[model samples]
Target chain A: MKKQLQSLKRIGFTVGMTAALAASSLAQAEDKLKVGLMLPATGTFAALGTAITNGFKQYVAESGGKLGGREIEYFVVDDESDPAKATENANKLVKRDHVDVLVGTVHSGVALAMAKVAKESNTLFIVPNAGADELTGPLCSPNIFRTSFTNWQPGYAMGQVAAAKKAKNVVTLTWKYAAGLQSVDGFKEAFEKAGGKVVKEMTLPFPNVEFQAYLTEIASIKPDAVYVFFAGAGATKFVKDYVAAGLNKTIPLYAPGFLTDGTLEAMGDAGQGLLTTLHYADGIKNAKNDAFRLNYAKTYKSQPDVYAVQGYDAAQLLAAGLKAVNGDFSKRAEMVKAMEAAKIDSPRGAFTLSKAHNPVQDFYLRKSEGRDNKVLEISAKALADPARGCKM
Target chain B: MDFYSFLIQVLNSVQYGLLLFLVASGLTLVFGIMGIINLAHGAFYMVGAYMAFALSSLTGNLFTAILLGIPLSLVFGAFLEWALFSHLYKRDHLEQVLLTYGLILIFEELRSLLVDDEVHGVAIPDVFSASIALNDTLSYPVYRLVISAVCIVLAIGLYFLIQRTRLGMMIRAGSHDRDMVQSLGININLIYRTVFALGVTLAAFAGMLAAPISSVFPGMGGGVLIISFVIVVIGGIGSVWGALFAALLVGFADTFGKVLLPDFAGAIVYVLMAAVLLWRPEGIFKKG
Candidate 1:
């Protein structure tokens, strides 16, 4: 009886394999759009990745379960925010899954690895969150487009905006990383050019949360303003600690939008009136934004944050490219051109792609008001990355 | 830095040192007493922080949340000891490390599934949220001061328990000769289980107390775990007093390093550890 049962199970497995193989060719003829989501699905950046995925899926739903009149199938891989596994994961998407396009990533290091894979595979990749300047500046590719702001852009904008606000002497604090270094460099350049002085710079190693000693230093130095770069939990702690230290009252605290992005929920009243610069803001009054916001909140059951805007715009960018090529992705050049020239009327604002394929968008000077980024004004308009050293 | 600034940093160092002691105490206990190298100790801390976050929200009171969190943590720790570590008492260090490392992964995945990866803040109770003004411009958070005070009380209590109590006597005897202790009919298994559970509870309690200032999140455990291991090693494994002294040394070194050499702050702690090792190869408090 056992032998017969084993034989019967073997026969069932063979029949199922035959059915799936037979259907493969039939399904291929339909030519569904394959999108690979290589975001960090379960780590420090998991919430950011979740927002990006949500925005991407919401657009697909809004577009009647299709992008560019083609049914889309998604292959999602959690990048785990480990730079070592990033290329391996991207290779799986490009080689193993043969995905038509790749959408990813939150960590700058991991995203850089993904960019390398995109370059080698010539696979169209949309960056939803990571803002490494090198992706557009030195290693810009015709195949890559970023819906997010570059690391330098918003920081530079913040520097200028703060300078205009009469914060002539600012002290900067952040974790030491490519993103942090580049952001501080960008801020210093603009701030000094606007006749400001950076008294001193202090940076701890990346992912370190203890900031009390540094807070003491800042209090002692007593800079006119504090410009910091922190994200997620670090940002939450820094804001809370900074305020608790009583520095915010005397030394106006400023940072790139990362200090507030997706962190307002955790920050609570601690972030109120905290001015920040970012490519997206809450009070961007427009029909396009209204529709996107309504749909996103309705779908996700929460207010859409900046990260979600980037993800939604990523989907919009992809849809535009697919539509321009009439969903014939085989016309790779035309699709790439379409994506490169794509003008996105994002929830943030109307942003067009630069020659380097990074977003040439307005940076909004926003003030955090009761769990919302109230748009004060445009800090910088139509800011385009220099894309220095890029042949493109 | 001015005198006032230096004074503030000193306070920062002490506050940080006390918190480190709270975390490393439990790590040293299990390593010193139970003869088990449990890398999953940090996972217990992370879970405690997570539990505090959840219960604080559900109970709407930080004190009440902690009241519920401790026993729950104790029970969880006891369960882990009974189910897993009890069998690993005689296992080699490498096997114990590998097993506990696997447990860390399991606990992290379990946490992620249950809580997702959102950073949650535990609002300090009103009583502890107040600030003590050091000067016109410099003020310290009351929560931090409270943390230092609580850790002092804990250290004294832990010292008296280990030195004066019957369980402490048994634990000391077992650490010296487990087989002899067993032969003496002292239920060595129960002692191991109790010590292991107490260590876990202490680590979790540290996490709970820290949630307000640290702001609970994923991967927070890993950082504390590394620092705790450093404390255990430098203080001599299984020596609570060594853990305390080493923790304060690291805390002061780290705080001063960050202020003096922000760029090299990350390496300074390890440098101090290396220097200490060069002086005393087996740690400052290692016995025999």
Candidate 2:
């Protein structure tokens, strides 16, 4: 009878332990927050995507690997910078993985598609890099927020700078794409407002780097200055070609910051003394920026660029919302309200969201100097996107 | 545009055309002689550009980089032909396409692994870096002129190699009847290998020449490949002279089209291709 009682006790202990373990795991699952990161991991934008991921994870890791006392679980999907696969890729994270919040994307077209998916599912989405105007304009929603500027902001700011410099008749050149077109429109809006006339606008097909024919045309037009919108390898080639063609000697070239940002190193001496406007520069002096830059360099072994800053700010915005709602995503409306209203202390500096949920930030005029985009001045202070078509 | 500016535009078109010819001549030769469709021809161009970037940095001179890169690419071409392309010659067009297409991906991935995805600029030699002032506002880079000159010399060399030499006769006969040339005990396989190597060398050499001006970057090959194919198609599949003519025509159309019809500039090349096909379905020249 004693041996049988001992055996029964052992069985009871085992059952009790099993029940407790299951209960704890269930609670942990409920408490943890799921975040899906859909960004390009391959193709042209791959490096940008990796930097963004590092910045996001760096913020999370700084908060002891949790946000607002909730453990963060991450799911990643490579959108491949292909807009055609954007819907499918986003769905894999939202409907399939059932993530609570979605963060993505560098390519504007892919980001727009991801925004569509996020809206249909009523999931919270934060755009880290893409600057598509429609995201904040026609498609604005309470659950949608962007940590980056519109494609219009930097261009418009540069236009003001160019006008102040007394460039009376300017010519513009860019690849014929939505981003390029919108950027030129923004420049035109501000320049024309400042009594500056655009003499000519020339464009080639997208991803075509052959600019000799166009350079020849620009030479003949002889505008006071030339403005262009090109990024990555195209930007590098254009700057080199422009200098090589001796156009830079005769015509002052201007652009939004993308012309010199990640491409300055490859551009070598060709990009020297070139001026551009953007939301971030390498020499912003503040305790916040200083500390952020130091910590990022320590963690990643590389200096954080505009993309990394945007990614960090996305996490910061999410953290603000999570903190307000006490880590309960069921209180999503309250969380989103907190996100919209939060004044994020970004590495780019402090910025607040506009009514359309785009960043209302300062745009800086930067000069390319020795592989650095050195800050010249604040070109536009507290610049807000018009968000022309938004009802929200 | 004034006459001087028009002259500048013509000069630009010819220079651009010559560069395209350097790449397309190889594509035509490979197709015409080897009977193998090399989709990775552009990738070879990219490889050459990257080689220019890598070797120039090491040797500290673009000229030396080209000098070293030629023999290396020749050996690479021969090895590729011996190991992979030789097997594909006996296979169907679909299989050849599949293999060469796979090669493009492999080459791109290898490039990424070796060089990373950052754009790199190869410094132009000091001797050729200056620009000749065309007028008060416009000047053309002397490097571009050097490029045209080199391409012209290579074109002459290629012509002589194919038209004058005993090897050229053998190559011509082989293209006409491969079995007959083999029965003549000419070691037709060795000839094919030499021809393939020469084609690769030309394409790579074009890439090297373009590197300083173009700014080496990922996917640089893709654009050039499509245009090269158009040149190949328009010039007729196996005709080098036809390729030269077609490339020049394309260059003029593209340059003029950009000036006159900016909105339709992108479609102009394809439009030219469509017009050519309608006029001569097999292209501008008959097969060799």
Candidate 3:
């Protein structure tokens, strides 16, 4: 009887300890916010990914590594800018890591895959860089949001700039792909409406840098201006080749900011005076932008571009939502409502989200000067995506 | 298109074709004489382009960069052969493919570590930077013409070296019967090593010459590699002459296809490859 009583006392002690541990762990879980970052850590888009990650972390750091009284825990996965692996990589973060929110991706194709997974799982997702229109148009969810402009935004703004320049006949060139085609479509929609003609729409296979044939044809067509959509290494090569072929001297080149952003340094004198449109530029003289740029350069040893701006705004949007709920994820409806209504004071300037969850922001006319896309003027004010296929 | 535009397109085709030849010739020579399918040949081209970018930045002249880069590439090629590829010779094709493919990954990773993945421009030598005006708006960069001239010169020199020299005789003989050449007291291994290094040097030199126009970037080799393989296969694998012919044919097809059928341009070269394969299973030339 004495031994039996001792065994019961031991069992009671174990039960009490287990209850205490469980209660503490539950409290800890509620106090932490899990953020999954699925970005390209390798391949062509790696540098852009790094800049975005830096910008996100920079904001969190400024807030003392906490958002809305909750400590932030980050899980990172490199999507490799490959769409084939994007679903699996996102699932690793969502299903396995059980992250509360997902932030990602520069490549449009990979972004689409991540959006599908996020939609299916009903996880909160914020796109920082990819400008795929479908993300906000057809595939948008109440849980999904974008801090960056749609692919159409900058392209449409540039078309207005080109038409205002009185370019009667314009040629559009890009690699044949969804991003390229959509950008061209955006350019056509705005330019043609403004009484300009797209004389030719030329495209090569995706990732093909050989532009001699196309350039030769462009010269023959003799359009008043040439608008192109190319980014990264392809952009640098095109700018240099365009200058080398003497087309830049006779026929001016117009493009969205992607043609000049992150590519000006490699373009040398070839990129001088090249005009493009974007949501952010180096010469935006606002106090918030100044502080953000100063802090980003000091912390990362690189100047923040539009991509970094988008990432920073993504964090700001999330912080606003989290602040509304005091880190209570169970109050998700109220939190999401707070996010939709919040005006993000971004480095690009103050912007609000459209009904489709895409940023309604200003697009700036920027010129490539040395290593900077110096802001010339505001090209468009508070531009919003049409969200053509969005039902919600 | 008008006559002048067509004339310019022809010039573009030829220039592109000649550049492709410089890269494809090396592939053919390595395969013909060594019986080794070098998947990493394109990586050597990338190395050359990067060297041009680095050396030109240091020296401030692309001509000087190429002058310095050639010997460095020769040494690199020789060292790589002696260290890793020499062992690969006795292995089967699968083993060779695996090893060379691994080399490509290693080279790309090393490039990323050494020089971050950013596009870099190599300035054309000042003398070759000017454009030759063909019409009011159409002008051709002189650097491209210079590239065609240099490639033609190299091709002639390569022909003389392989067809007219004693070393060339030993190389051709060794390719045919390695054991017989060894029995005849010739250092067949040395011949193979020299041939391999020469092939590497040619590819690297082409890369250096093209860098000013192409702009050096990562994965640049991947595109060139596929085309080089096509050239080698279409040119009858081992024949340098055949590679030259195939490269030009592909260049014309690609250039014109882009002009005529913009939507189908990417498929045109592969279609040409298929047609050629159907016509001549051994390629345009028999294995030498």
Clash counts for all predictions: 1, 0, 0
Distance from true location, Cα of B20 in model 3, Å = 0.8
Candidate 3 chain A weakest ten by summed lDDT: A22-31
User: Candidate 1 clashing pairs?
Assistant: B32-B238
> Alpha-carbon interface RMSD of model 3?
1.1
List model 2 lDDT by residue over A116-234, tens digit each.
99999999999999998999999999989999989998889989999999999999999999899889989999999999999999999998888999899999989999999999999
What residue pairs are clashing in model 3?
Answer: none
Per-residue lDDT of B44 in model 3: 93
Which lDDT tens digits does candidate 1 get at residues B1-288? 888888888889988998999999999999888888889989989988988899999999989999998899888888999998888887799999999999889988888899877777889898888788777666888888889999999888988889899889899999999999999999998888889889999989988998887788778889999999999999998888888899899999999999888778999999999998999988999965
Give each prediction's DockQ, rounded to 2 decimals: 0.68, 0.67, 0.66
Worst 10 residues of 2 chain B by lDDT: B279-288
- After superposing candidate 1 on the true structure, give the runs of residues whose Cα lies further than 4 Å from its correct spot: A1-23, A26-30
- Please list the C-alpha lDDT of all candidates, in the order they appear: 0.89, 0.92, 0.91
